[model samples]
Target: MSVQFVGLKEINGPLVVLDNVSNVGYEEMVELVLEDGSVRTGRVVLLEDKKAVIQVFEGTRGLSLTNTKTRMLGHPMEIPLSTEILGRILSGSGKPIDGLGEIFAERSADINGKPINPVSRTYPRNYIRTGISSIDALMTLIRGQKLPIFSGSGMNHNKLAVQIVRQAKVTKDGGQPSDEKFCVVFAAMGVKNDVADYFKSSFEESGVLKNVVMFLNLSNDPIIERILTPRCALTVAEYLAFEHDMHVLVILTDMTSYAEALREFSSSKGEIPGRKGYPGYLYSDLASIYERAGIINGHKGSVTQIPILTMPNDDITHPVPDLTGYITEGQIVLDRSLDLMGTYPPVSVLPSLSRLMKDGIGEGYTRADHSALANQLFASYAKVQDARSLASVIGEEELSPIDKNYLEFGTYFERFFINQSFEEERTIDQTLDLGWKLLALLPREELDRLDSKLLDEHYHPEDARMFRGA
Candidate 1:
């Protein structure tokens, strides 16, 4: 038999307290029946002694303290899981909002998923190509890695995310494409209605909607739903990757919104605040989400995450990006300055890298020359910064010959290599070949990162002539 109680203790912003309740577990789902007999769903967020505080998913209004009835569902929140979830659009709480109706679940899973045992994790290897030159040639996203994109408000991270979804793919050794079943799980939290429409329309127009599962939580939705958006998305990803043997790429945009929702929830709970008024447990909470990404020991499918967060005022030290940098493999940073200069992706090379790139590229992977070429590009770009600094100090025409070459290389590298159009997708070979062409503008001695053999194979000083007049 189930236990039901009449609510009376207190009603506080999205929360309802039921005093003298027994045997209620935390995070257990609840049902609230109003005086009018309309039902609302909630979960137990707090428990002390015989008292349980339930957070209603729908806002708490129009409920009579005496007439409302509460019942515990005995389990944490779970979402339906099946292969059919693909090609579907869902609300933040995993409900179908596309008028497609309910999922015929093979099974359901807890949205707060079980952590993969560290000992059972397969070391991430190989790569998932984003088809953006700056990422593929430089940062190199390894399969099953949790790499983040650090951006700022009003930047084009949304457009970049759309482009990545359109072009990302897995490749075999030596840059051959893989035929493995691949799909994307995209979750957008606290986005405006138009922004939500933009994402849906973009994926549909690109003909990739059939391969994607989207969970959208608009800004007008309750904060509780915002908190559930990524969890539901990841739950679907885990189901696809571990159970169905699919390579699932999960892209979560504007994680800053999720963090802020947590803060708001914490404030409503009256918990002590930490840095910038965020809850102190913020790091662990973030880890719980980020750590969910990786490969299992025997599982052929993998889950790779590209979590995008906006740094407040472009401050990298903000708690959201600061903690994310610690948890993720590495980051792809977008630069406002580069954006202003007409760069489409605006990936700032110096601050962006994939920590797993070293193990994933070269030989059977991307290319044998990939590692050395990336190093030389980094070194040369560092020198470009120096040359620009000198030019700023003493004027451009008076700079040394080598410095002028660096200046020219910097301009072409930015214009041609980094500033690709949203519609352009480059192969790994094409990206590498472009890197070498830009490096050709520099003198031979400056190419210290590459050995003689690689330079002989890829270096063509004549390629520099194409940029001579420009």
Candidate 2:
């Protein structure tokens, strides 16, 4: 391939301005030769008057415009795809971060990616088992869905993510091949060594390493690399799911750091800001990553995403999670108060919802009554929370018999529903059975969302009478 030289015009913090570039798209990566004879990569961020602003990949630690020679790579960042990559470790930039020897790939594909045509898209229907009762019962992740976990700092979302990666599988009855039905791609951005060690240890102890691939960017790693982590992950997911015919689940943690990296790069180029000083193209940039999921027609394998983002200051309206909610299917929201109360998952079922749950659960996917049971359980638990607040104000003695019953349901909901562990894998049956156990302490007449038949089959009023008598 022939290359052209575009002399560097200026240099800034981790950024360079190259003059006379004919064809460089935004966010496209390029190659640069510094004065020290070192070759590094950079990305095109702006195009103005035949000059492009490029963000240095490894950072502008030792680079100068006077001696920097810019070589247009004529392409975007790509990821190496092969079965040999499974159980391997890589950096955020798609390089071997684990210090293992070079990986042999059957082929490599560009990570920038081509837009998936709507006509070529197939409706995602198959359910991916996450082994979390709160998710499997309520969210019911679809095979090709892009669902994100929105949580606050210090929550167990990371552990929950690891659990999902290890436990998420397509059951036998679901017609998925036992071999490829379960696989995971885990990527960590701005995470510490202990956290990475925990993930590695968890995967090792759980014996899911053979089916999992990890790409890690530690907290001390170059912040610029955070921008490439998810893209590399999505590229791997595409390869595994499409080329290898495997059901691949990709997990990205601390997307907030990724967004902040974007923000910093955008600011380095002096670009106009959007919401909270983020780029205006933030939505489209996020969409490019999220839209990679889904089952295409004629492809047996599928890619599913479970990106975990920590909401800043426990603010759901933060630009990162807020924009993510708009792009992805739905969110599994975590509660801080419940976490303080020692709940493991701390999933606030009331505010948290899965839009695709209806498509993946009930009738055939799970039990026939999963929808009604989850809905009624959510309703009863919400009422219990309300009663708890009332009891706090007026005292438990002032609460009516039914109010007291609701209070009991609330306590049971926390201990059974929210308080869960990564080692524990609960089925839909267990989730609903637990739901029934919670509802048994409540008056049956209050189950307005559930049908009479389902209530009779699942809910035992005699048990409620005994609880009331006690």
Candidate 3:
């Protein structure tokens, strides 16, 4: 038998308070029956002193206190999982929206998945090539790593995200795709209809829709759904990676929107606000989502994450990105300044980093000189910035010839190295070789960070011209 309440004590934004309730567990699913015989689903979010607060997944637009009845389902929210989920488009609430009908699930699992034991976690290795020069040659993304992309509003992060999904590959030595299974799980939270359609059509046009699973929570959808979007997507990823043994790349975009939803819900509950009006448990809440990514011991597959969030006012100190920086492995920060310069995928390589980059590159994984070339590129770019600042203080003609060379290097570096078409995908070797090609524009003696042996083999200007000619 189930417990049914005749009426709600109070109705708040997306929340219904049931007073004098007993034995109601947190996160227990609830079903609301309206007078018109329509049913909606919700879950208990707060339980205290014989009172329970249920958050309805569907918006509470048509319900009234006298006409609404709530039933406790005695269980938490769970998503049906199966191999058939691939190629399907689902709503944030995990319902099929593609008109393909329901999936025959193998089993239902909790959306909030269990944390992997620390001892059971295998160190992440191997590289997932994103085909972007800035990412591949500099901040290399390793399998089982959680790297976030930080952007601001009006930036083209959506295009960048799609490009990564379209071009990313799992590769071993010689830049060949590994025999391991690879797939993508993309989730969009609080996005506009056009943005959602863009992702769907982009995947379909690229002919990779069969290997991608997409969950979309649109702007007009219930706010509660935004909170569940990434979790529902990751649940599918966890099912695919651990149970079916597939390398899954999970992309959750506009996490700032998700965070905003959290703030709205928290404000409704009247909880004590933390930094910038976010919840006090914000870090743990984000950790639960991000820490789900990794390679488990004895597992043949991995779950890598590229969570994208827009920084409010491009403020790195904002709570959303600030907390994310602590949780994620590293960040690929997009620059508005670069975008103004007409750069596609305008990645700011200076602040960007990949903590797991070293483990995934080198002799056996990528080229043997990959590390040396990346280090030298970073060092030389730093000098270019200095030279530009010096020229700004004094006239360019007053600067030394070496300073002028650095300025020229910066210009070409941004044009030829950092900027690339979204449709143009480069292999790791191409990215590394291009880095050397750009370095050849500078005096070879300035390349102090590169190994002497690598400089002799890959950095000669004569060889660059010969290779370009060939």
Which of the numbered candidates is closest to the native, going by highest lDDT?
1
Task: Determine which window of 10 residues in candidate 3 has minimal summed lDDT.
Answer: 461-470
State each model's CA lDDT, in order. Answer: 0.94, 0.82, 0.92
Residue 272: error of model 1 in Å?
0.5
Ranking of candidates on TM-score, top first: 1, 3, 2
lDDT of 3 by residue, 358-421 (tens): 9889988988899989999999999999998999999899999999989988888898889899
Per-residue lDDT tens digits for candidate 1, residues 106-190, read: 9999999999999999999999999999999889999899999999999999999999999999999898889999999999999
Q: Candidate 1: what lDDT?
A: 0.94
Tens-digit lDDT track of model 2 for 61-109:
7777577777777667777778878888888888876667888878778
Task: Tell how far residue 441 is off in model 1, in angstroms.
Answer: 0.5
In candidate 2, how many Å is residue 120 off?
A: 2.4
Top candidate by TM-score: 1
What is the overall TM-score of model 3 with all chains considered together? 0.98
Any runs in candidate 2 off by more than 4 Å, and if so which? 4-7, 23-28, 172-180, 461-470
Better of 1 and 3 by lDDT: 1
Better candidate number, 1 or 2, judged by lDDT: 1
TM-score-best of 1 and 3 = 1
